[model samples]
Target: MATNQQLTTIKCLILDHFITFNELSSIISYTPDLRRLHFSHRHERDTTIGSMSSIGLTNLTYLSLRIFSLNFHDFEIFIGKIQSKLITLSVNISPNDITYLDAYRWERLILQHLSQLERFSFQYPDSVDNEHRYFEGLNQFCSPFWIKRQWIFDVKIVDEGIVYVIHPYKKRCMSSIALTNLTYLSLRIFSLNFHDFEIFIGKIHSKLITLSVNISSNDITYLDAYRWERLILQHLPQLERFSFQYLDHVDNEHRYFEGLNQFCSPFWIKRRWIFDVKIVDEGIVYVVHPYK
Candidate 1:
């Protein structure tokens, strides 16, 4: 339908149907004022045409891609052909597309083309069988560029595999992607406070079954089992298995307490998540583990 006339004042395009790179070019070429494009691309739609012509979308500041069966190499070619100073980019790559997690390629691509980008979100659902192989690749996201931006690679455990998610330190994690399938989750996020966590936890669907979190805290409220009990009981009703290790540093200014023996409440008893504490070299470790 868009093959005939030039769209003059179009500002955004959400095309769930994508045929090929050339088709995308042709569509965007018609919409000269396009500022955003959200599209889905699968292998079936990846048809080869003649040489791809260079096209500039100078006003296109936002781009989102839901990749179903496309390889990272093909995605790179598609990105290279589009000239846009993207301010925000979000991508959801399907399971087994590990190449999209290559932070080096992203660094190069952003620096070369999307240098003006500010917000970046990436999600990859991968198999838990290959979990060990992914830890090393995680270091690539820890480079200085990401550190300055306070971007952390978060691995959320699900039923089939882990979902690798990255977003700004204090922003919503995976706001665009629905994690209703998330069941078992074990995560260590040092940059979140109770408010941040409350905002995050409230967003997850009630399908989470098991949760294990490790936190190093400067805020004493993180040690308040009563607060956690109230929050989780109110929000995460389906959560049965629970484990946590909270590190209260030795040099904390607001004071430190290792004797908060309030974990034996009805909630802890029901979940069988017994709590204990230990003195590490740097801090006191308060732990909660399920019955073996």
Candidate 2:
């Protein structure tokens, strides 16, 4: 049995599917003191909430919505109606959502209204075409803010732009963001090269304490165990924790395993951090190392 008295003190609401405006409003109406709301939905042409009658979630401090169909106007209106108390906001691509051919316009449009956002996660899946389209859109979208002195304190791009931009030159281009204030970063598809990886670590080494990189170690044909350790310990000096997903096809599994243990030694490790190493082929293996 339901009672009206049980509704007033609700603080958080999370929904897995898209809800109509009326349905969202009814939920909001039932909880006057709601503080957090998270929504994740896919495939369907979902609606973005905006200018609701119950826009009085005074205690609201966090809001995250991940819907497949979000445009500039939708974001503009949605952000306008959000209560100022929000401190954390995140959105990710739905697992089964079909992506548009190009997200350049979409990314440009959405980021224009994100000046006040604190945390962001944007993903476009893993495919050659999608990689090109996602970063082309992302690079252009962020170009305007490149010279601006604001920091994306926490940012994540998962399996989105790695395949298209996989060289030292591209890494230098990416470092233009000058993530001076960035403290947390997680990347899923950094291409398979040690030089490019070195430049990347050098670019953000100072500010980042947490890092995750997943790439095929098979591409590192010349990167014997020694070169790998030198690159990380020398350039990524501040990295307290390090994680690598080796994807080599060579039969030298024993050598790679020995190298892994050597590199994760405490002598070269810096800071106190969390590490997660995940390797995938026909089967997947995940190893976690944390500094205590």
Q: Pick the candidate with the highest lDDT.
A: 1
Off by over 4 Å in 2: 1-7, 41-51, 94-116, 126-135, 141-292
Query: What is the TM-score of candidate 2?
Result: 0.41
Candidate 1 off by > 4 Å: 1-5, 129-132, 171-292
lDDT of 1 by residue, 234-262 (tens): 87788888888888777766544544677
Candidate 1, pairs of clashing residues: none
Best by TM-score: 1
Error of 1 at 234 (Å): 29
TM-scores across all candidates?
Answer: 0.58, 0.41
lDDT of 2 at 227: 68
Q: What is the C-alpha RMSD, rounded to one decimal, of candidate 1?
A: 12.6
Residue pairs with backbone overlap in model 2 = 240-270
